[model samples]
Target: MSDAFSPPPSPGGEVSADQRQMALFSHLSSLSGLIIPLGNILGPLILWLVKKDTMPFVEDQAKEALNFNITLGIIGIVLTIITVVTFGIGAVLTVPLGILLGIAWLVLTIMAGLKANEGQYYRYPFALRLIK
Candidate 1:
């Protein structure tokens, strides 16, 4: 049994402070979607690719972040298509639903970052396991 004072263990042995920070960044990077097109996917992808060789913890967190963001992006695209195709009628439904999902994404991503910062493996409850 582990004591409460001990830090959480990561899958890849002892996680360094740098690794934890990178992992946290991996999860938080998804928020960049608000500024750059496809940034949600690209941010994690870049981080994962750049650090996967050296930081296993970061790789794990980045993959989770990437997959979750990808799933959210797909859902968002579908909602947008529905709204456009229905000529604003779908907005009555899709808009509110989209907003809710957006909030969920933000909340969940923040939670994941906190977990990663604590040296814990965080998995998205709804993310598709498309990356691995």
Candidate 2:
């Protein structure tokens, strides 16, 4: 599966600092969820659309970020529905599960940003490969 996550070839041996910063921004964009619902997905989607052609690294990392955030958003909605359907009984489990998922999303996004800033590709484990 390493082949699946491998970065697209760079014509030069090293990625430039500007490319790395843009890639980092793609991952960091997810934090905008705090200000707007689904902003996490929208932020990276916009960045990817604007920069993907010019930056292979940004394309790969932005796509990964979008896929992961979308997956998490879906899971969170499912858990919320379970809580409601169960008449709040499921809240005992679902609430904490949602919190854990949020925490994981936050932590992992930060880590991905750091890796991208270093000019290394980072793939989020357990993210559904929903976007090619």
lDDT of each model, Cα atoms only? 0.88, 0.89
In angstroms, how far off is 5's CA in candidate 1? 26
Q: What is the Cα-based lDDT of residue 110 in candidate 2?
A: 98
Model 1 residue pairs with clashes: none
Instruction: List the candidate 1 regions with Cα displacement exceeding 4 Å.
Output: 1-12
Residue 93 in candidate 1 has what lDDT? Answer: 100
Instruction: Compute the lDDT of residue 90 as modeled in candidate 2.
Output: 100
TM-score of 2: 0.91
As a whole number from 0 to 100, the lDDT of residue 48 in candidate 1 is 97
TM-score for all predictions?
0.87, 0.91
For candidate 2, the lDDT comes to 0.89
Question: Given candidate 2, what's the lDDT at residue 14?
Answer: 85
Best by TM-score: 2
Query: Which candidate has the highest lDDT of all?
Result: 2
Residue range with the least summed lDDT across 10 consecutive positions in model 1: 3-12
Candidate 2 wrongly placed segments (more than 4 Å): 1-12
